[model samples]
Target: MGGLIFIFVQVLVAVFLCINFMLITTFFTKEFFYTTMRYILFAVTLLSDCVILIVTNLLIICNYLKITMNLWLCAIMFILSTVYSSVTPFTLTAMTLERYVAICMPLRHGDLCSTRCSLHCILLIHGLSSIHFIVDLSIYFASTSIKFYKQSMICNVWIFILYRWQDHLRNAIKTLYFLFMCITIVFSYVRIMKAARAASGEDRKSTWKGLKTVILHAFQLLLCLIQLWCPLIESAVLQTNVKAYINLRYVNYIIFYVASRCLSPLIYGLRDEKFFCAMKSYLLCGFYKKKNVI
Candidate 1:
């Protein structure tokens, strides 16, 4: 049942992403060159996440059917998840920084977030995400010790327990990395908010828009942290009911993923008056065409 719901929500996200990609690409072709680059970033991010969703959902289906989800399958899922989890925040973080400079330093934003600079930023983000993926996945697969635990009535599972100090060290480092990113996001937003608060005259509305952007990314970061990290923290530290915790956490995970994907385009489309008008016009024309054909 959980697997079914997960697949349903993820599929919806994939569809939403496809729509958003089309809209972004079309708009970019008609607008700024840098906007084209932003569209490319969004398209790649959506495609990568869609692949992760499909593969992970398939793994869940195999598990539900009482088939042995092969270790290799698990490894693939782990790599995909690592890529999704790590890459998403950084991409969003970069977007936030882009918006910040565009608003606060419009004259310099072009020079600062140039095509080369943007590509470099993306490369740095992917490089970091890849490094984390390799380290964590390597540690996961290399461990030989196993500990068994009963999960929900649908799935009982055993997991490899990593007990060595070095293993703990790696885990701590990963946790701290995420923690640092979260802190950076918050701190950046704080500065953005301060700038927003200090604005005057006609620029105030633009400042508010900037503040909204910060809020949107902040909400996303918070949601991702809560969905991804909270469960592991609770299970490991508090020795909670693992089954209940996992089920609850998985529900939130699906909710957050769907929300994040769908919200990205919807929020941007509505918030940008030009995009909103374009979307409205597009939808209305489509509806008119369908009605006439019918």
Candidate 2:
């Protein structure tokens, strides 16, 4: 039953991700390059999710065969999850910062959000995120041992998630990284707000728009923290008392995944009036044309 449910969810996520990728691509055509950073991030997220779905299917296959997975694979799985978990916030932060820069520092927005610079920023994010996981995996593997027993044409592998100080170090670093990123995001927005306050007349409207953009970014980040990390933290700290929170945790996670899929389009529609208008006009035009034909 668990395996069936797992596969069901995997297929659901895969299909949803593919649909989101297509929509995002359409919404962020190259002509909208400066504003397409959000779409680009969504594309990366869907790609990462594809990796997750493939690995999850492999895990299900191994379960069916009663084959114990190799330690390397287990480590890789953990890395994939963690990297996606960590990098997503940073990517979101980048999008928020870009919006802030565009609004609060209009004079420099073009220079800052150039094609070459955007490419460099994307590469830098991927490189940094990869390095973080490589260091984590290296430290983890160095301290862990994998034991395997082969019988009945199957390998039963036993893995210890904790080895030496790897778990502790990983937790510490992860927590710090997330905290730092969150703080940076908050600080950037606060400065943008201050800049907005100093603006006059038409600039005041732009500042208000910047504030709205920051709020949307913060809302998504808050949902992520509540859904993904909050439960784990409470579970660890509450120990036996965690049972009381299980219901809320389950609900939060469900909401989180649902919201993640819905957010890219919602945020784009809310922030970019032009894009939203285009989408609405296109839909209305199609409807009228179909009705005329009928």
Top candidate (TM-score): 1
Q: Candidate 2 lDDT, tens digit per residue, 148-189?
A: 322123221113343546556555666666677678678878
Candidate 1 segments whose C-alpha is farther than 4 A from its true place: 1-45, 140-171, 233-246, 281-294
Give the C-alpha miss distance for residue 239 in model 2, angstroms: 7.1
Q: Which residue pairs collide in model 2, if any?
A: none
TM-score of every prediction relative to native: 0.74, 0.70
- Residue 26 miss distance in model 1 (angstroms): 4.6
Report how far residue 229 has shifted in candidate 1, in Å: 3.3
lDDT, candidates in the order shown: 0.63, 0.61
Error of 1 at 165 (Å): 5.3
Candidate 2: residue 53 Cα off by (Å)? 7.3
Off by over 4 Å in 2: 1-19, 28-30, 34-76, 144-160, 227-252, 256-261, 277-294
Deviation from native of the Cα of residue 67 in model 2, angstroms: 8.3
